[model samples]
Target: QPANKVFPHFVPSLSGFSLTSEVKTQDVEYDVPKANSTDGKDEVLFGAEKGWLGTPIDELNRMPQCAPPLSHLKVVPNHTVTVRTDLLREGEVPVPYPTKFKDAWDDVSVKMPCSEKNLFPMETEDGGGVQSRWELIHTALQGGFKKRSHLTILLLQCLFFPTLSSLQCLELCEAQHLFEVVLPAMVSLALSAPRLCTLPIPLLKSRMNHSLTMSQEQIACLLANAFFCTFPRRNSRKSEYCNYPEINFYRLFEGSSSRKIEKLKTLLCYFRRVSQIRPKGLVTFTRQMVNNPPNWESSQTQLTRLHITCEGTIEDDGYGMLQVDFANRFVGGGVTGHGLVQEEIRFLINPELIVSRLFTEAMEYNECLIITGTEQYSKYSGYAESYKWKESHTDETDDWQRRCTEIVAIDALKFRHFLEQFLPEKMVRELNKAYCGFFRSNTNSKHLSAVATGNWGCGAFGGDTRLKALIQLMAAAEAGRDMAYFTFGDAQLMRDVHEIHTFLTGRKVTVGRLYSLLNQYSSTVCKNCRTTRPDESLYSFIYQKVSSQTATDALKVISDGTDTKNLW
Candidate 1:
């Protein structure tokens, strides 16, 4: 249970309508974080994280609208509350308080006001800034949102990806779900509110194991299953050991020299500052150049797959190549480089590792591998490769890894935009079709039943096969969208169909209060257009059928099974 998790209970429809309910009037306040303990160091040390993150007026907007339309009061003898919306308030979102929404993850509170001023009240050192931790929690509580929740989600999205380095070195485990739960809901809610229905999509989890909305790669991958988890590469051949030559002397001179040389003999005051190499690919590996630290006379070398060296450089350049940040890679962390290196970076044919879906077929050819080693001496030893070159008496360049660095660049620009537009639209269109069939009183099909839950690929839910590779290409922080994809899945579970309407309208709505509110959609009409639309086509047809059977079946139970039509 030490692992982190977020449970999503609702996705809002954008049309901004509401269900029938007795209005509960209450004041609002929020919570925020503030500057507290000192560093106790010589001069106090502080970071920008405190300044921008803690609290602000813009951050307190998480509370849902004060009064939205309500769909109640017109009750028949059978208990079905016939919702009348003309008298309802406008734009309302109640903090969802689920009595039976399976496992609601975070804490829930509704007996108090929602605001940061009276919540966890705190001011800045100069009384210039403010913070509200309570406001953050209050935003995502009982109702659909609080401003702090929105702020929390935004911060995570920014960090989920970094344009600078592939080395992800931060620990933000708590903020994951604060953004994850609201993303798809907010997106779909924005889209469907006015239409009387909305399409549903799953959120994805980034490297932190916390869920997130969607990243560029994940969006593309889920859009058409064109991408999956991997970079392009050939498979390894039979058990063959690779042999990349060690670094030589001349190579040292080309390295940036920040750690300067000292008196005639100071044992390697010869190194320089590390130059950050900008990768043309999605993940940029910033290799820090540091003075070789003393390791008790012991020397080590890592067989890197690629490296960059200067042209016509000799072996005696007093330079060496190495790898750092390997520890962070081996240990568990968030999902930044996982898509590219997340899986066991080994041969799929070996069968000990999960094959990268992107390269599974391609791995059958052009296999590549790396080999390396290191040696040290007690006294003055010229550059490493210099001696090797002399010992061989042959003018051969012993550079393999560095030589592998080529000018070839992979084209993945369209991956993000394609997914952003494709997946959501595909799901929406499909869900819409399903909605049309079941509700019109003229057409309902049992054939669409499979949409409630199904599978698209190898995942437990309606798995999206393309998301793996595409997400790998996205920067780390925002990649959590895949987790949401798995959890929320396709409407029919991505089986015979993988769109929105097929899945949601197909399943039995399990939330009791949600059902009651939705059931009122049977006779609800758009005030502006005078067009009647229910939450779902089937729900509509059933409502009409059941309303006709009001004298027989208990209308209250039926009404409780539908969605309130207060949505625009």
Candidate 2:
């Protein structure tokens, strides 16, 4: 059974509340400190330099060098693309060879009409008729279809054009441009797949900092093949790709839902934009792992800087910072399915990210995937079930080494029992996972940027927001990065987090102290039947304990005759 369905909602209590407990109905406003101008150099934040793009590409462990050897390519030109038909073999020579083409068509066949096949006549201009969408796609794949084929235009029209009653002039024009210009060019690019993917794409395996860099054209070609559902052994769980996320467009095209339609609109928009102007920049995907775990109780790392707010989103306001993706262990999560949360929406706008699922293995607990240089193509409104594609977005963010944006994907644990999260072992697991994502070994310590994150693992994963905020805070501080926390419109959470952060920083709290406090709190909760009392919350406990400890320290100092004059 799914964990979410099994766990009851567990709300924390706040007894002995010394802090302001009144929940604010209105949005709380806070000012984010601006970075001082660096005269075209990297900005500095909290005594550390901002952004990692200035670091050399080679130094970052990026693959597919500026000029990679063609011999490393598994799908070279004038050769057959050898799809991995089984698990990767040890000591095997990965290469492409001539072979017969085999199609692994699934139940969701593309033969069905974009609309209803029976609704329109199938007659063509050449005194013949097209039977199915597959025929057109197959012809294009074999390089026999004309760019101006009327049948292709009709199919595209059926796919994109809405019913006449609701079709506006602008929508019609966009659809017209897509079918007439963008799609044909993309189909042509797909035909040249052999040349575009000339470099051997390495699988970003577990426990490694393996990076793969591919040009935008190469990504487009790969996506084009996905659109055509040309990749073999990818449609079924019985195939070798059973361990990988689905890459073909069959599932996207075959489904019927308002959610699916909106996703399709977003994808079509991405294809249209890329087809018109092929991007020249390169994107890198790196799988990062942490072999040596931190000793949470003994570490003396100080809390880094923090900027917490209830307004704005991680992607929008957190620009130039290392953005966090509340992801599934499967990488792209449910972008290809019904999911429309933070990670899925991100993948849709930046469709290039979808390519990572092709070679990225299912992540381990100590692993995270970092993607840099991918551009956004669409804007969106609403979330989850209410998600809608708003319009095209033009990104003007500056790039370093042809890379602009950076995102780190981390999967949080899904708790089966609500109280299980309070266990010491579970809390430690979360800290290490967040630390792995935030840590940057390739760059100098002074060059690490702040992390932009929100209520990670708090939504469907059932993580307590207050606890998660603190966990990420400790992890970021240990990794030597500051943080900007967005509450996703939770005003009360934002205020509470801000107050706690101010208290910790003002008290000169160390990471070790914080970790010890967390364990103490866990022990208290366990002693009380593994559930917090209605009047007892993590915040109140920390506030009361820290206050008591500070008072005791002052008393001790006075008794020892240290600063007695000041105490009097």
Candidate 3:
């Protein structure tokens, strides 16, 4: 009988608090990458040699995504362009490609809607919006920087953006600092890098099938707003923006340590890059979720082949395939949290993924978020607090689009109690989650590649490494996709998983049959060891039931440890 049929009674309640369940709420915050605030404490500037004051993000000003040339391109008003990330052939969509920054900027700027005379809602009967906005900006500067001499100059310098002509007549300081200090700084930084006017058309077309292109200037403006701590609706406890990753410049302002200085230097470097160089390519964010996706019990798909390895990181080894991000249920787990992990690393490298938090609500088990064409900004050497931004990363793009990497986020469940995962219902839920992520649409399946994953839930989530590995394997089989499993640094798992896969593949066992075996194993094993931990591992236990009687010799070989080297 199929596992579902015989193990019908083994399906536990999908939603119930177990003995290990505990509610956690954090009042403490961490100073991590991209932590910004409008409280004036996390100011984005410094004085002279040690000044943390705002530096001109020239790239954002120059490459506004919604600015003129492409501004005329019809899209949902106020929303950036949305495009598919699936692979596409050359010349499929005929859109004008500008080869110079000036041309594109002028074209788009001409189409920019005229700003309402009453732009600020809080404007008085007189024209006080500009002054009011300035006060708001001035007030958000860190306390020490809020003093007169430092404050006026910083405000004037910030107004150096070409779009803010409204501040021209403001009687702040004489134009000396604004013109000589700030304008020159901004211009020097902008001119230092080549203008990103031209699109890497050939490379973009060849690499990704579809994408959403945003102007670098637009990105710069957003970052500038973040840097100045001017973004509104970002500070409340139950903020509308809470679902989104924190984008304001709050966390960087929360400290005076060497780490914060190092981060500041890196942040300045990023702004400098944005100001000087226009990206030679485009970026696309695509959220892939299967519609009417299959349930585990009814799945009949076969596993695509895979390669299991012990050493190497997922980003480096699994460059082109849809790499998996072991995410939190909320997505981008504690990326801003004090403790860093794989998901945090992924977010740091492709900072663009953080934008998904703006619109994406908490993730359900069967949903997955995918991103394509996000560039990596910093290179780091270690994990977590030991993680340091080593240097700027310039990835190659011409023939292969730059940052045309694809990442799918699949959040593994956090079992409060280790044994709760053994329940058949939980296993089925995990299977469905993985299958939704792994199953490529019929049209894209031929071109879609296998998945790269490892130690996904083995870290902070308290998941059993072996069990998680098996769940991923079964899901891949159901989706008919190959998998490249990265054990991160776990060498032993590399061996044991290889043996288990080899054993299963050799038997030519179908997923339905494996489900049946898993069901039988869980029920029998749980009944026998209700009070104490099983003496045997789950893998050994499952093997004992599935192949022990028929392949007793194989079991003996594994148990003896003499046949370990050539299991595959």
The number of the candidate with the highest lDDT is: 2
| Candidate number with the higher TM-score (1 or 3) | 3
Backbone clashes, each candidate: 95, 4, 34
lDDT of each: 0.19, 0.65, 0.51
Model 3: per-residue lDDT, tens digit, 197-259? 122211111112222454334344345445554444444448544444554545544434334
For residue 485, model 2's alpha carbon misses the true position, in angstroms, by: 0.6
Reference-based lDDT, residue 559, model 1: 64
- In Å, residue 442's CA in model 2 sits off its true spot by 4.8
Where is the poorest 10-residue window by lDDT in model 1? 267-276
Candidate 1, superposed: residue stretches over 4 Å from native: 1-353, 356-568
Q: At residue 547, what lDDT does model 3 achieve?
A: 66
* TM-score of every model versus the real structure: 0.14, 0.72, 0.63
Q: Report the C-alpha lDDT of model 2 over 1-568, residue by residue, as the tens digit.
A: 1111100110012122111223334433443333321122332232122111111212321112212232332323322223332322323322221132222233322111121231333777887654655444546445432333443344344334222111122233344554456556767766555445543455566666666656666687778777766554566889655666777665665435657766766776777667767666556677888988789999898877676656678778776678899999998888877788999999998899998877777899999999987878877777887776666776642322334578999999998666778789999999999999999775544566678899999878989999999999999988877788888877678657766776776677789999999889878755576344324788988999898988888899978888844322
Clashing residue pairs in candidate 2 are 13-536, 13-537, 15-535, 49-446
Ranking by TM-score: 2, 3, 1
Q: Give the TM-score of candidate 2.
A: 0.72
